[model samples]
Target: MKKQSYGMKWLSVEVVVILVGLLFLAPFYFVLTNSFKGFAELLVDTSGLPKSLSWDNYARAWEVLNFPRAFLNSLLITLFSALCMVVAASMAAYRLLRHPSRINRVLFSLFVAAMVVPFQAIMIPLVQVGNWLQFLNSIPGIIFCYTGLGVSFSIFLYHGFMKSIPLEVEEAAVMDGCNPYGIFWRIVFPLLKPMTITVIVLQSLWMWNDFLLPLLVLQKPELQTIQLATNTLFGQYLKQWDLALAALVMGIVPILTFFLVLQKHVIQGITAGAVKG
Candidate 1:
């Protein structure tokens, strides 16, 4: 009787899980199905499958949205920003953890405090500063901004994980005549693989998907990211639902591919971090 009850409970839980997943996926189903539809058909029956597969919407979206350029731009920005944040945050966290000076402690506290401060609160001042620095609409400019904004959270993650590492590891490296930079590059960094991957994946997703920052900073059509490019498909009088949905799908595919490939590492990183502290 107990075994039967356990099996029944497991089946019930499985059914609930499947239902929840379907609930989340239903919207994507609509988008995917309607992406091949004509605008008229979409307006008439938004939920139905296409009468016939239409490749024109995807092709038109690609050309009108300048998807190739946007994809390249997003790739460059996200990769550079993620790399900068990971390298800077990892080094900073390592030194701060090893040394633990009062200044370092105060600075780390300030970073954590900054994380709690909403980005909306400082958007105006940030824009003013960006304008003053003449970084308002440039790719390099936005990359720098992403690095700064991403550092705090990355540092927080690294700092927590670094606590689990032994001080003796650094001491051993130093005894072997390793300089600070050498120790960090060779020994410390290698041990930080899991956390680093976690930071890269999370930050890459955020930087790639972000719309507001790009919209605020980049006015030039040539400088637009994928998200910004998709927004252009919408008009005051006519919304190109088919084209917009296609572009949306195009923008999502790369990130979804990335997550699928690195999903195991991501899960392990989170699990390790949670167990450590």
Candidate 2:
């Protein structure tokens, strides 16, 4: 009797958790299904699946949004920015960990402190600086901005895990006549793979999905990121629900595919960091 009761309780809990997950996923389902429906059908029944599959909405949205260009722009920006941030941050973290000087300590603290500073507070000043630097509407400019903003948190995560790496390994490499750069590149960097993967995955997602920064930085229609392109589907008086939804689906696909593929590494990276620390 007690075994049966416990099984029932477990089943109930599982069902509840499933229901919660469904609740969170409901919006995505609505967007995906409605994207295939006609305007009239969408208005009549937002929740139900479309009576007939229609590819026109996606086709029209792709052309109107210039999705191919937007996708490429987003891909380039995100990939470059994330790569720069991970490499720079990892090197910085490694140096800070190995050196451990007062100045490095102060800088590390500042990086941690900067994480708490809201972007809104400094957005105006950042924009002004970008304008002064002629980075106002350039991809490289946007990449530089993302690299700077991402460094603090990335450094923090890298720094924490770097301490777990044994100093003996670096010292042995040094004794073998390896320079600092050589030692870091060959020995330390390989040890940092897990944290590096973590940083790459997390930062890539942020850069790929980022809307506001790209919107402010890239003015040319040809340079707009996927998020910016998707926003163009909605106007002041008229919102193309079908097109908007289609664009949204397109925007999410790449990141979703990336995450699905690297999910194992991502989880392993995170767990390794936790265990090592």
Candidate 3:
């Protein structure tokens, strides 16, 4: 066998991919660069780099966004929401795979169906229900909401991953001394690390960056997450671009870092999940 020759067609495709990647990255460039500029400088030269790097905007944004509290709020909501989705989805998926009875099949179909139903369509009703249940204006309420929204897609992924796992493994565990919960926790769950990381990363990105649900539920300033807190920089009369951008940078860095660290697992998990389910 010989190496394939490089051609213009491949070069063209590579260039196109690079351009598209840059297009997507443009917003990040703008946000990061402008965050260091003054309001006047940003307005004067939207695309140009700042004449001098300034840390004042970030300092002000830190205090304005109440960085620590906001970060904590976002972190807690994301963590708990991911936890709820993972445990519920993985167990449900495992059960569905192991026993594909009529009711279970129908239940799985409903979970798939729920994935297609856009959240916007059910937003109002969900809000009303939350209000009725008195779960509004609280961190737990938002985490609860995230769980409900995220579980379907997560279950779908886990169901696929579960199918990839041989039943003989579970049987072996049963033959040894492992009970149901023991088999799941000690034997199966560890094997699900890739898919679990995928679910956590995906859900964390959603919950961490989420604005609409948090806005609707959390009205108190003290309850604000990173996105909600950063949004305070914009008003009808004035938009604090520099500070807002700085806060925005702060808001995105953690989630971006998280995705970078676990991105390989994400691809593997999604591929594994898609193999059967």
What is the C-alpha lDDT profile of model 3 across 74-168, one tens digit per residue? 99999999999999999999898888799999999999999999888999999999999998998899889999999999999898888788878
Model 1 pairs whose backbones collide: none
Predict model 3's lDDT versus the native.
0.92
Q: In terms of TM-score, how similar is model 2 to the real structure?
A: 0.94
Q: Backbone clash tally for model 2?
A: 0
Give the deviation of candidate 1 from the true structure as CA RMSD.
1.3
Ranking by lDDT: 3, 1, 2
Task: Report the number of the highest-lDDT candidate.
Answer: 3
Candidate 1 off by > 4 Å: none
RMSD of each: 1.3, 1.7, 1.7
TM-score of each: 0.96, 0.94, 0.96
Candidate 2 vs 3: which has more TM-score: 3
- Estimate the lDDT of model 1: 0.91
| Model 3 steric clash pairs | none
TM-score of 1: 0.96
